[model samples]
Target: MTPRAKTPRNSGQRGGHVLRRMRASTVYLLLSIGALVSIAPYLMTLNAAFKPQSTLLSTQAWTPAVPATWSNFTALWSQYDMSGFIVHTAVVAGTITLGQLVFTTFAAYAFARLDFPGREPLFWGFIAMMMVPQIVTLIPLFLIMSHLNLIDTYRALILPYVFGTPYGIFLVRQYFQTIPADLEAAARIDGAGTWTILRRIMIPLSKPILATLATITFVNTWNSLLWPLMATSSERDEVVTVGIAALQGQFASELHILLPAAAVALLPLVAIFLLFQRHIVRSIALTGLK
Candidate 1:
């Protein structure tokens, strides 16, 4: 009967459809604005990196009347030891990422698939620990490092990563749950041990999430300032973030130098994200599904 009434041209239905589309368009516009707002700082950094010191510090619009100079980059590379900082950051990030992934994966597999007394309680304890702020453990961790005589060494940094991260274990455990038990069962039926099953079956299926986690861990460690600052005082042990902050302190007046140094510190992460963006997106989706 309502459809029959619509024989009068269905203007109301058409109007409703038009209104829905308009609402959708408005939502898209709002989202676009939000995205632009989020991206503005990075855009400004990029532009300022290319600009001269006077222009960078000035309150002019993003684009200047005159062409930008490459002297900023040259000065930063020569004076700030940016290349050395990059290598240091890469080493720290790589070591931490590998340590976290391996230990976390094993711990996650044990918690998820293995049977043991008090396993559930231990896993829950780990979950509870995640609720505790990292600040609470900083003093204790420092004391432990101090006692071991590992201060200012790579061991001071790498030892903390060897035990596995609560976040990493939690993330991997959630992913492991999504994996079919049938695969594990088949491997076991074929006399494959737990290690074999995990390495051959579970790990292979979890490439996306693993890649994403590795990327995130690398970025985080590379940008870590507080711990690196506390752990290592010498420029020799400096990571990129601490190096950039140090550079900022040294070149206070030279905005051109400072901005370009900051840009250099950010470039590796930006490049990594750009290269692995698709993998990151897929891994995030998979992680969410878990």
Candidate 2:
């Protein structure tokens, strides 16, 4: 009988370990570069907001101010109606976010779980609405508002959008479908009705997707410009987006003020993302699995 020789294991193991490390390092490096590229413009905007006019016009506009100045912000809040615009923006965004949450949650639950006449057709019809360019509806919406004498009012600003959006409904409906139907069946066996199942079972389970939808609604409503401009003629009712646009036109020569207003307008969305980033990431991962 002859014995066979075993191959050496050290080189192969060390080479594979080293290869894994190299791949991980490459991934991290690429992600860091991508993050920097995405954030650079925001950094420049915030930096320029604090820079003096002299520095803003210079070639080194991206450089951080030596000692950051608050004059631009002060001027915007005092000389213009920036503060009021911010308040207006917050109210509208908050209202729309809340409305979408309530309406979308119920609507999605029904579409996902309930069986009704024309259910499939109605759901697809809503999907079809998403493809219709929003601008085409603007004229009809305006005419309705005008006839109702709601122009330049908060209702005019909020009414059209406070209803659930097709995207919101779709997002929530898909997420709801991902839930285990067994949970609802068990709850029903224990004397739970539709509302009980929704309030206790579904709502808690849907938090991540709801948070994602809320953040999106708030940001989109805050950033809406065209509808606000067309719906509200009064400066007192102006949103930050519309206000910033007006400032850009009027203060075209004043980069200092314009930059500060623009930077300040971004703070709410940044705060929302920072606070809910975990939920957003988790929901996106869960939804991706769908």
lDDT of 1: 0.83
* RMSD after CA superposition, every candidate: 3.1, 2.3
Which residues of candidate 1, in runs, are more than 4 Å off? 1-20, 59-61, 64-66
Clashes of 2: 0
Candidate 1 residue-wise lDDT at 276: 73
Model 2, 74: alpha-carbon shift in Å? 1.4
TM-score of each: 0.89, 0.95
For candidate 1, lDDT tens digit of each residue in 126-237?
9998899777877888899998888888888777765677888888898899998998998899999988998899999888777777887888888787787878888787
Pairs that clash in candidate 2: none
lDDT of each: 0.83, 0.92
